[model samples]
Target chain A: MGNDALNVEHSSGHSAAVFRETQDSEQFRRLKRKHRGFVLPVTAACLLWYFTYVLLAGYAPDFMATPVFGRVNIGILLGLSQIVTTFAVTMIYVSYANKQLDPDAAAIRDRLETKEGVR
Target chain B: MLHLAVTAPAAPGDPVLNIAIFGLFVAITMVIVFRASRNNKTAADYYAAGRSFSGGQNGSAIAGDYLSAASFLGIVGAIAINGYDGFLYSIGFLVAWVVALLLVAELLRNTGKFTMADVLAFRLKQRPVRIAAAISTLVVCFFYLLAQMAGAGGLVALLLGINDRVGQSVVIAVVGALMILYVLVGGMKGTTWVQIIKAGLLIAGAGVMTIWVLAINGFNLSTLLDSAVETSGNPAILAPGLQYGLSDITRLDFLSLGLALVLGTAALPHVLMRFYTVPTAKEARKSVVWAIWLIGIFYLFTLVLGYGASALIGAERIAAAPGGANSAAPLLAFELGGSVLLGIISAIAFATILAVVAGLTITAAASFSHDIYASVVKKGNPAPGAEVKVARRTVVVIGIVAILGGIGANGQNVAFLVALAFAVAASANLPTIVYSLFWKNFTTQGALWSMYGGLASAIILISLSPVVSGGEKSMLQGVDFAVFPLSNPGIVSIPLAFFLGWLGSVLDKKKESLEKQTEMEVRSLTGVGAEKSVAH
Candidate 1:
């Protein structure tokens, strides 16, 4: 929506104006809210989990070293779990995006490009 | 440099066989690139393969590009010697991918074109942000390329038993020339295909070694772990004290390293650039999912490969090798499968470098052509077909520079070199992405400050921080002028980079910088008016 920069000679002023208009549009705001709704809490939780593992490894060596099985200890279990958690989070995000975020985003795009015929 | 540190210059592995395997892989990659270039018609063709890749294919290609010699060779070797500490890197690298996939990848794909600058300048003032981003991309790409080049030279020399500078330079030159050809001819399409082949070969090679390791330990993971701890002869390895647990300072260093690895992988320019190779934002997300699976499986296999090397080869022997732990995999190959297997693994390692440097060369060339030449110099009026020509020329310049840098860095501890790149990416590029995507208040001034400040601080810290100027292990040798305590700079520079960005935006109340925040937000989220797929 910001200035069609490829052809526009004075793109700065025009680009900023286009975005200011988009900023005021209700559909843009709703689309952003939906994206933020799903993304924020998930990212926050993942970071917290990641840091806890890293901090435990850094500061609580004893906790990390506590024996879970014979030679397999708590630290190694946690480390492997980190890999497992990454896979789970990815699947969760992808499924959530497919079900919730993608449809609404596609709708917004269609409204812009086809309904309103905005370039 | 990392490989040379592990293995001494013993008689090289097998010149005739190594060369044969190396020649075969190189010749095939060249043919792929040569054929792909015939279809090249525009900047989009040169840069994003005309957005032709499906999610799964792009995913495989991303894995090929991301899994450089560092992950394939360095981390496995590091773990063989360092125990859980070595796999810590694997965790950091993987977790970072997850973070980027969930939060960043689609946005990058939906917003950016061929380079990081496209995304950064989406909302901010265009010229200044592009300039800052080009510099940051160049800095990150240069160091990463240098490390790959040096690693390739050392791996080849050690494998082929080449002892002198002449032999090593030949290795460096051949690699440089091949990579130049890939970028000049293949553009993104050829490079992506080469990366796919490399990823497949790497996975197969690593999978074989892991299976061999598991077979040796009777396929029981616990037994393998126990044997690893026992054979290591260092009880501390089973715990966390071997690599970074010695003292309080080292512990801080460990945390800093963790921060760098986790954030660094997300910010890597080449890795982010891969998202553009696919067309739709959905494909972008799928590409990341595919990368997670491939990278997840690959890293898990690396754990087995690492411990297997230790249990099978013994700690002292791995230490004694000229390349240190870097020789663990090849040595393990030879132990399990004899000379033929070792030769194959070495050849796979060479292919790994070729794919990685090709990816890096193109990314660097894009930063030069798209960011610097098209966006900055041409002032957004790039004529049709002009950008790709400049890109081809840029590839030659980068290839030559990398060859020289690699030759200069040969035989040094290139281990930490990649870490420095990660730190720069984390400190500089990550902030730029986060701010541009999330921060409504982010201005052009803030973007520039963050990019340059993070880049400069990372380089300065790394140069002074024992990696370059410390003791015998340091590149500077006997004279120790290293004042920076930790080798990794993430704990300091990353926060500083973010802070500078926030402060600069707050200070520079440019009304225009705030105006496009919503437009960038909408477009990045919903892909309105994003570059449509160019029909083939």
Candidate 2:
């Protein structure tokens, strides 16, 4: 209800048409592809890694219990690695988004907002 | 369950010192909240703190909001008693941020205005989607509040040596009242400040204790573990299965709980609502990064503290304490620095409850006011200031309800309540949000089906699960209605909700308008039109 862009859609349909055009544009397609392409696989891989750890902790206690270093077993190491991987993935995504995603998004956003003068 | 009869050790620290520290914290946060609330004249200010918080600040608040007493006291206590099994929970909770950061945060920040409903209802039929989202939000908040409230009763009673039920109930009421005051006076702005302050104190307190614990063992983690092993007389604690490895059924239950904890964070309504307090999608991303680091580091501290507690105080004492495993951190504090340290840590724990409850209350209030009252009840045309007024009233109503519910649930094995809240959020909210954000073909019918069906299945399964009735530690005594084996319904309900969402969308012949979908997609991905609406 507070959205002028949505209100514009109901009133004139011009902004809606423009939105559809932008949605179909090659740049927008590229943006979506780049964003989802990185996010989806990374998400799947991280989740797979995490669930694998969970399962090992559940079903394979002996393997996890195999002492890796003094008093620290594979389970403790694996748990620590999950934390490491979380921080690693977060940093990777931040850099990736900063370099690969934001500029394209800003360009697309600026063009639309400038044309509509919604601000 | 047999451990319920174990009397707690003579009160660990000075109760007078604990009360003094608690009073000091309450007074300081109250002043900050009142000062911060001066600018809250509009609905946006009330709900989103005028989008004034930086990424790092919001990150601290997020960490504060996310790290309930359950994580601080509960996980540490778990590790103290159960060892490696307790560490699994920390891993699951930390890894959950990946899902939030990569999939939900930025796009949601771009698409929505106030609550999770704003994102889900963006391209769909607004009223139905908003109503459904509001219901799920309220339910999740209510359950989470119940857990915190029950924890508050047991925790404060244990600290102050109040053995009477009347004293515990009074403590719960006072917590509820303080929560109401924070939200009523500070709104999101005040609540966020409380969260920030609490997060700092919590992390700092944990960090000091962690260093102290490591120092006691000559800075050797292995030595600490060795001492813990010696003291507990169980090297099995160093390995998994001390808790969850007894049988295949418990193992499978661990898996279910893991599934819920990992997938649950992004869909949590209070957490989602925090994303709106930041200025941009990039800032939202930054906040998650900040939160992951702060929370991840905090959990790492919990691991040390847990091992330290087991090493110093021994597992038997922790398990036999008044609050059971939830007293591990406090006990460790008493061990390290006597009554003063114990007082400070206990006060931090108390602030943890107050801040978390305040966050939940404000979020639920916003949902009811913005989604249910303003959008649905007013038919999207309420007069100026009406929404904020409604939100204040809703906060009062929710506070009273939470007080009553907390008292009713006090002294019960309500740890399952928090897990149930996670299950509901993961099942009832996550699927629809993912579909709406990614799938252009998602419809109103699909949203309704996913939200309502997911909610119903989660509630139903929880009621029938061992957590509610059949088990020795269930909420109900001497009743054997539990047919479901897994305590958490997530492993079943999460996939079911996703399946129902896909099925409903596929079956619907009536599709949402393409123009609206385009607007949402463009707006969500690029942040266009979002700032125009959210800015002023």
Question: What overall lDDT, based on C-alpha atoms, would model 2 receive against the true structure?
Answer: 0.89
Q: What lDDT tens digits, residue by residue, belong to model 1 across residues A11-96?
A: 32234455556667776677677778878788778778888988788788788888878778888899899999999999988988
The residue-by-residue lDDT of candidate 2 on A7-56, one tens digit each, is: 34333423667787888999999999999999999999999999899889
For every candidate, how close is chain A to the native chain A in TM-score? 0.75, 0.86
- Native A-B interface contacts kept, per candidate: 0.58, 0.64
Estimate, for each residue in B1-536, the C-alpha lDDT of model 2 and write its tens digit: 11234455666899989989999999999999999998889888999998878889999999999999999998998999999899888888999999999999999999887899989988888888889999999999999998998888888766887767898799899989999999999999999999999999999999999999999999988898899999999988887898999899899898888888888899999999999998888889999999999999999999999999999999888877888788889989999999999999999999999999999999999999999988888877778899999999999999999999888877788888899999999999999999998898898888889999889999999899988898878888899999998888999988898998999899999988887788788878888766422344
Give TM per candidate: 0.95, 0.97
TM-score, cand. 1 vs. native: 0.95
